[model samples]
Target: MHDPATHHKPRIAISACLTGHSVRYNGGHKASDLCRTQLEEHFEWTPVCPEVAIGLGVPRDPIRLVGNPDHPEVVGTRNPGMDLTGPLRTYGEQMANELDDICGYIFMQKSPSCGLERVKVYQDNGHPAFHSGRGAYAQAFCERRPDLPVEEEGRLHDPVLRENFISRVYAYADWQRVLAEGLNRGALVNFHSRYKYLLMANNPQAYRTLGRMLGTLSKDDDPLVVGPQYFSELMQALRRCASRGTHSNVLQHLSGYFKDALTPSDKSELQELIGQYQQGVVPLVVPLTLLKHHLRNHPDPYLQQQAYLQPHPESLGLRNAV
Candidate 1:
């Protein structure tokens, strides 16, 4: 399997249409400017259009999910008998098995074969049903690797979701690196320590739960068994969106490290910035930038090592909008 950590740009899988490829049924692209321009520098994208890859030609008949929302069949919109579900699922399983190094996936929204969520499902009468269905390939991929960070391009427009998705991608890549090198108790402990604050901001309960699990690791225990369990919990925790209160709590906790080094004015200003962030008066970048500046001046080893400080590259400017 390829290891993304070895590459300068983390590998990501994206819907071909989102990359401006003419792979849609209408032979057009649903290009995402952010993915093509802003995030292009940070990630090496592998575009996959399940419809196209499954031998559905360009300008092909449109398809829709029909049957139970939870287990729908992809069939032609004009001719319900023209089913394409089997081929799409086969292609998805093959892609999921092959793309083990992909750190994240960017799905095209509302696609019958790639949307992450809420893709339309039609009834037997050819009328639209509730929007509770996921794309066929997307469903297969999620089942294959639930730990991987997955998001729809449209949802990435939301600042909070975008930040969370990118953060998860970096964290997942780091976790994969640990597994690739060798999974040992010490490495796992160090990984958890670095992500302490980041995990707390996502879910305090999981932070404590995972810490306790790591604390109980024994020499007799198999790392392969324990590691999967830990990762499953970690991914589930990250899916919980962090709120302003949680972020403010984490920021305050981080500020304590520089309390002695900061002057009275500096301390007051930092607290004020954090307060503004908590009250939604400012984005997280404001206080985080100040903290980063202080960390440079004071140089606390533990604080400097925390992934919460720079979860992803600052060049991505993810926190600017958050």
Candidate 2:
């Protein structure tokens, strides 16, 4: 089993209000117990409140996104002309430039300055016209680091999204470590090989596309140029949540490696467990446990090396929820 405490915890950027800080416009906190308690052991958080950083006081008037949903202006709800968009964007850009070590971010949902998605955009007449706008700081963060895994507090409540977010965070950290060690064609290829099944479960098309990208690498190719493109695609691939069907496909593929080693009864039992998982009759942990059991007995080198079997720390119990 992977010892999480022995591994380096990924640095994560989190909204200050979510960390139990009284940084909200109403002078209250929207403390997420999950972040403060559950995830503390796994993540090192860097709390930030863009509004507060930009000189907005606690208990300040609430702000809203106005005008175009795609490019909304941030302004005080009580005073339309009181724009904070410029200051927030400036702060966001600065954070993006400086927070290069952050592997992921957790934003407060529906925040005018920090929401990840579906923040309300009001019309000139003051009616909420749409929920299509993203928060100013969140938008800037995305533009700056498209590779980073980002999630809203509300969305993280879902088991699948929560699992996916943590998985990506760990994966991104691993990629960062790889780059830190000096990325070369050989190192990149080895990295991709380890994540093969994981990428397939999330998005088979992207998995194949990335494989093709790896195939194009040459001894003379520049790691500096190729590394960015590879990671960009890898992150985008991971952004697509792994579905039951896709997971089943990967599981079945893994099972094939042990087909010759298993008896008729063992094979039947494994197939049934995978079927139950695909049908949502049981959590993913069931089939995965069985697979690990067989893997221990069989010990195929390829399957043993694959990251899909243990993407993140098991202590987190992420698979149990999904």
For every candidate structure, what is the RMSD over all alpha carbons to the true structure, in angstroms? 2.8, 1.4
Per-model clash counts, in order, read 0, 0
lDDT of 1 by residue, 1-322 (tens): 1222344677999999999999889989999998988899899899998888878889999998988999899999888789888888888889999999899999999998988788889887877786579999899888998989999999998989999998899889889889999998888888888888989999999999999999998999887889889988898799777889999999999999987899999999999999999999999999998998998899988887788888888888888888
Stretches of candidate 2 off by over 4 Å are 1-6
Error of 1 at 173 (Å): 1.0
**TM-scores of all predicted structures:** 0.95, 0.97
Per-residue alpha-carbon lDDT of model 2 for 203-227, expressed as tens digits? 9999999999989878788978898
Candidate 2 TM-score, true structure as reference: 0.97
- Cα lDDT for residue 101, model 2? 90
Candidate 1 lands at a TM-score of 0.95
Give the whole-model CA lDDT for all candidates, comma-separated: 0.88, 0.90
